[model samples]
Target: MADDPILRLRGVHTHIGPYHILHGVDLDVPRGGVTMLLGRNGAGKTTTLRTIMGLWRAGQGSVHFDGRDITRLATPAIAQAGIAYVPENMSVFSDLTVAENMRLAARSGAIDEQRLDWVFRMFPALKIFWHQRAGVLSGGQKQMLSVARAIIEPRQLLIVDEPTKGLAPSIIQNMISVFCELKQTAVSILLVEQNFHMARSVGDTVAVMDDGRVVHAGTMADLAGDEALQQRLLGLSLAAHQ
Candidate 1:
């Protein structure tokens, strides 16, 4: 392992009821790069993200960030440590104005004018709807707000789960651009996505999960070269481009 991996998980495991999810998962998220967790629908990708966020505590292994062991920290404590999570549902406050919603997101000395400017630059549509209520915004707009609000502070690492899920092609394109631009700020991103095209487009490293375990880990280029492995581990029905 490197001297300072932004985030690392070793032998992580989780369960719901009697069903165990993660089976001694190990991952190293490099600083200022995108690492995508790829797998089929039931492959425990979401469970891995949840464990990192403290929403699902692993019974074993350790989750470390910036050389500190955070596997036992509470969710709020983890969030205050500069980790932010953007779930797939895009849960924005429906009654609040966009500015109001963004203000609320700015927590523990997080929200600032510079952050606002960066978010607005990524999604000009958010600027247009600054005064509107969140409930009325389209799905794409809501997703933008959900992500932008989280970034209102200096999030050392951002975890987004299935961001492009159920979105229209146009909206998906827009989201890809937003995420790509965000990398310019040098924020490490741990992305959980099933969409092969989107993952390959933004991910620097790719890990394939199956049956609650990480079976393959490598750079995006390496994953692209292994067609049989992609099909077997990820069930990728089509060819993936680098």
Candidate 2:
């Protein structure tokens, strides 16, 4: 089964300064589908993501990706290993044009026209504003560009953190469609989101985190259907949220 999960974490503990954030976190991102990491604010979801990316080193335990131990690798090294991260901030270069941003994220120093065309299909705004500066775009458009940049090149896994944090309802629906399309591709996705509606829509598997540890893991359909389980684990029913 080790070959099945593209990414695995075991007892991952991360500390930022004197504050202990992630405490013995364990998770698995199965190959070729969306695995949603869901939790309330301050539930250590972000810390867990940062630790996996090697932005924050794990104090104990291990992180394995594509069958290799990457617990101690630096951020750049981890990225080079074919993992792409789209942080919540969207991190687009405000001064750079949309085309410039894509060029920067390509990593190969050259953007492939075919891959770009595919990305444009998924997010038409990027194509419309190709020559425009990233800072001038709307929040939703910026998020699309952030995602487009990540997939401009081939990747084994894509990790996104709270992508729908501040978008409108229509934009959220668009994001749902984007993730759905991404699932059909060869790349796997690990997503952290608070919107249960979006989470249940795109997620094939779900992991719930609380107090820095994963409290539940199962199919998204199970979590969505069980109002009692959702109320207990997530403090609300998924159906009610939708």
Model 1 accuracy (lDDT, Cα): 0.85
Residues 130-235 of candidate 1 have per-residue lDDT tens digits of: 9999998998889889988878887899999998888888888888888888778878998997667788778888788888888888887777767887778766
Clash pairs detected, candidate 2: none
Q: What local distance difference test score does each model get? A: 0.85, 0.92
Off by over 4 Å in 2: 1-3
TM-score for every candidate vs. truth? Answer: 0.94, 0.98
Candidate 2 structure lDDT: 0.92
Worst 10 residues of 2 by lDDT: 1-10
Cα lDDT tens digits, model 2, 41-91, are 999998998999999999999999999999999999999999999999988
